[model samples]
Structure formats: structure tokens, C-alpha cells
Target: MQLLSVNLAAPHAADYTDSAGRVTGIDKRPVPHPVLVTAPGPKGTGGSGLAGDTIGDPRHHGGDDQAVYAFAREDLDAWAAELGRELPNGVFGENLTTSGFDVNSALVGERWRVGDAEDGPLLEVSCGRIPCRTFAGWLGERGWIRRFTQRAAPGAYLRVVEPGEVRAGDRVTVVSRPEHEVTVAFWFRAVTTEPELLGRMLAAGDALPEESRERALRRGA
Candidate 1:
């Protein structure tokens, strides 16, 4: 797999999002150069892990678990065909737009080493991107949340397991895969539409976001 481009947010105003001096950072654009990747401390305190991307709303976005959002270029192409519109690399607010990667099919806790350097950034598949109203408003699509959820290709959120510089065209190597069957898509379904599947989500272990893990735990209990 390859990193097609590294994208950063282009701040823009939106009514469906937080208005307390916070404009939506849902509009992301691809960066031409390499960018440093790091963990953004925690969920609410810090924003995007990329050097200069904006988060707009920290209360519900960012942090280590949701640090770097990635979407497959193929998925974008499929959406473009379905919507009959052009969707750019970062149109979905994904930090990394990947080609030849089945992001949704990635198992939780799977690790990827990116770039040519042996010390290149290492990222772990943490969870699936959860659609919010800000996302729906940004897309301007009717029933986008329902549409996206129904498609079940929510992309993937990654945690920076090893901090390093990453650039477009970087080779993405799957360094490790957990011995679990919980892919990102399955996890999304389990949490959002299939409560019965929540019992199976525990197989993913702590790789899931704390809230999701806890929710699954409570359900299984």
C-alpha cells in the first residue's frame, strides 16, 4: 500500500458545528511536503497529530486514538461515482489518503510502518471514523450519516505508535496484525447498528478507543 497524500485541514465555517469561535476543520487539503506525525496527548486536550492540521472541535475529535484519520482513494472514487461529483483526496477530512489499501478491512491493533526509512512512523489501526453532524454538513449530502453508515466503509483512525516524518508516496507496510477478527468495518457495525455484535468486539481488545471498549464491555457484562 502507498500513502497517496498527506492532508491537513482548511478551516471553514459551518452552522451544524460548534459556533463558539470554532469553525469546522472538515475541509482538508493535501500537503506537498513531508509532515511530522505524533500523538496529540489525549482526546479532548489536543487536536490533530499532524504538525499543522486544525481540529475545530476538540470535545469530540482528535487525541491519540483518533489522531490520524485515513481513507482509501478507492473508497473516495466509489463515493464520487455514487454521488456523481468529484471528491478530492482530503474531501473527507482524512489526514492520509491511501491507495491500494483496504482501510476498512484492517483489523484493529494492526500496525503499519510507513516510509522508506527503518525509523519511519509506525501507526496502529485504532478504530473506524464515526460520522457526525459536522461531517454531514460539510458534505452537504442528504442523509450522509445514514448513507455512510450503511455503506460500512467508514475508513480508519490510527494512533502514532512511533513518531517520524511521513510524506506522500511513502510505502505503507503492515508491520503486525493482531490475532483477532475484528476489522474496522465490523467494529463500526457492532457499535452503531448491531448491538448484538458488541459482544464480539471484545476480541479486538484495547486497540479500540476506550469509550468503545468500555461500551462493549458494559454490553458484554
Candidate 2:
């Protein structure tokens, strides 16, 4: 798939509102490159205490690569038109925006390579949907979380396989797929609705990360 837009967030002050009212954290800022590394605490170091969590669970503020959105090529023009700009800046408050890929079909353990054969980059990423309020706030729509999950385009949470520079217009290639037929949407369903599938995923082995396995086991038990 072709890259639509690459976004990033440095460290800016913004209002983070929750049950405790508004607490300020780093506001979302755009970055020059596609990849962004955020830690559980402030700055880009330290592990988020959450176990087996990919995007949410408080370990990551924005998480790895934080924002990488993908869309179908056919919808590109329409999406651009709707956003009032060539590309949307804060649609999901993402760092990267993409098109031409069926991102929804990606499974939890899928890997993707960026760039081209001659000069390209490789990133193996795990799939996970943006969680509720965090995602909703980004979209500026209260129902965005549900809408996104229902749409099943669940984007992805990425980790650097071989760290490198990636920009908009770079090519994205799917290098491999998980052993099972399960997809990102499937995993979302399994986690929220069918807790049993977590165990199934763990039993399937290599299909999921070690952290994911532990969480699944706990949920299943």
C-alpha cells in the first residue's frame, strides 16, 4: 500500500481530561518522521506497568509509532475532500497516515516493511485498535471508538524491527502473516466479547506476543 501521510508528536503541553477532571500531559505534536517512541512515563524511556498490553493499559501515552492510519486507495480522494485538506492532521491524532492497504485484515502478529526494494525499511508490528476515550478524544467524536472498531480498520501498533527513516509516499509491504486466520478485528472481538479466544490465541503460539499470551491466560483463567 502507498503511504498517504506521515505524522509525529514531539512534547507539547495539552489538557488531558478524565474522571479526575483535566490533567495536562504532553499535547500531541507533529513529528517529521513516521516513527515515534513514547514510554509509560514521561520521556521516551521506561516500561509501562501494564502487562501484555499493546497500545493502552497506561504503559504508552501514544505508544510506538503511535499514529499510523491506513486507508484504501479508492477512498483516498474522498477522504481528502472530507478533511478539507489534502490530508487530515488530527483525524486520529496520529503520527502517520496511509492509504491503499486493507489495514483491517492485518492480524495481531503481522509484520510490515516500509520503503522500496532498493532503499526500504522493515518494521514488524502488532495489531491493536485504539482504545475508547483516548481514541475518542483524538477523533473529537464521542462515538469514534465504537465506530472505528465497527469499521474494523483498527490501524496498527508498530515496533521498530530495524530502526530507519520513513516518510510519506513510502511503500508498505506485508512480509508475513500470522499462522491462524485471526485478524485484528477478530482479536478485538476475542478480547472484548469472547474472552475464550484469548486462550486459543495463546495456544496457537507464535501467532501472538509473549505479553499477549500472558494477558490471555489471565483472562481465560
Candidate 3:
């Protein structure tokens, strides 16, 4: 697989109808050059690993477990076809728009070497992105959140394992895959609609984020 584009956004005031909806940096735009990818501190830091990216709401965005967000070009294409609109690379607020990658099918704890061997970053799949009202407001689609949830293809969030520069056209190699059946799509479905599947998510072990893991365990209990 390859990185189609590297997207970043700075904090800006938005008309999003969620929780005051003031400083949301979800309107990411593609960058021409390589950008540094690193851990942006802790969970409530409200910043991203991408150099120019910003996280508006610390309470819900930006954390070590969510240092990077990636979406597949194939998925975007599907959405575009269904919505009958042009969905650009960064339109969904993803940091990396990837080609030839099945991000939704990626297993939790999967490790991907992004870029070349000479200079690249290592990223570990952590969890599926949880859709929120900001996303619906941004899209302005009627029943957008529900539609997205029903589709169950929320992109994956990743933790930076080896921080480095990443740019468009960089190669993405799956370095390792955890022996688990909990794919991002499955996890998204479990957390969003299938309460019975929450117990199954625990099988992914430490591959899941702490909060998600705890929630799954609680549900399973």
C-alpha cells in the first residue's frame, strides 16, 4: 500500500453544532512536503503527531493512542459513489489518505512501516475512530452519524511507534500482524451497535486502547 496524501489542519472556528463547536481542526488539507510524525504527548493534550495538525477538543481528540488517523482511498471512493459527491483526500479529517489498503480489515495491534526503510515511521494500529457530531456537522448529511455507524467502516487510529517524516507517495508495509480476529470494522460495529460483540473485542488484548479495552471488559463481564 502507499500513502496517497499527508493532510494537516490548524485550529479554526467552525459552525459545527456540537459542544460549542468553536475550535475544530477537522478540515484537513493535503500538504506537499513531508511532515514529522511523533507522539503528541498524552491523551488530553489536544494536539496531533502531525507537525501542522491540531486537535480542537482534547476531551475527545488527540492522544498517544490516536496520534495518527488513516483512511483508505477505496473507502472514500465508495462513500463518494454512494453520496454522489467528490470526497477529497482530506475531506474526512484523516491525516493519511491511503491507496491500496484495506484499513478497515486491518487487525488491531497491526504494525505498519510507513515510508522507506532508509527513512520511515513505525505505526501501530490502536483502534477505530469513533464518529461524533462534529463529523455530521462537517458533512451536513442528513442522518450522517447514523449512516456512518451503520456502514461500520470508520477508519483506524494509530499510535506512532517510530517517529519520522512521512510524505505523499511513501510506501506502507505491514511489518507485523497480531493474531487476533478483531478487525477495525469489527471493533467499530461492536462498540457502536453490537453490544454482544464487545466481549469479543477483549480477545485483541493490549492491542486495544486502555479505555476501549476497559469498556470491552466491562461489557463482557
The lDDT leader among the candidates is 1
Model 2: lDDT equals: 0.51
Instruction: Arrange candidates by TM-score, descending.
Output: 1, 3, 2
Clashing pairs counted in every model:
0, 6, 0
Score every model by TM-score.
Answer: 0.97, 0.67, 0.96
Cα lDDT for residue 154, candidate 3 = 95
Report every candidate's CA lDDT.
0.92, 0.51, 0.89
lDDT tens readout by residue for model 2, 91-139: 4544445676666577666777777644455554555554566445644
lDDT of 3 by residue, 2-69 (tens): 99999998457876734346878888989999999998878875469898887888778888889999
**Model 1: how far residue 94 lies from native, Å:** 0.3
Candidates 1 and 2, the one with greater lDDT: 1
Model 2 off-target regions past 4 Å?
10-14, 17-58, 62-90, 117-119, 203-207
Q: Which of the predicted structures, 2 or 3, would earn the higher TM-score when compared with the native?
A: 3
Decreasing lDDT order of the candidates: 1, 3, 2
User: Which 10-residue window of candidate 2 scores lowest in summed lDDT?
Assistant: 48-57
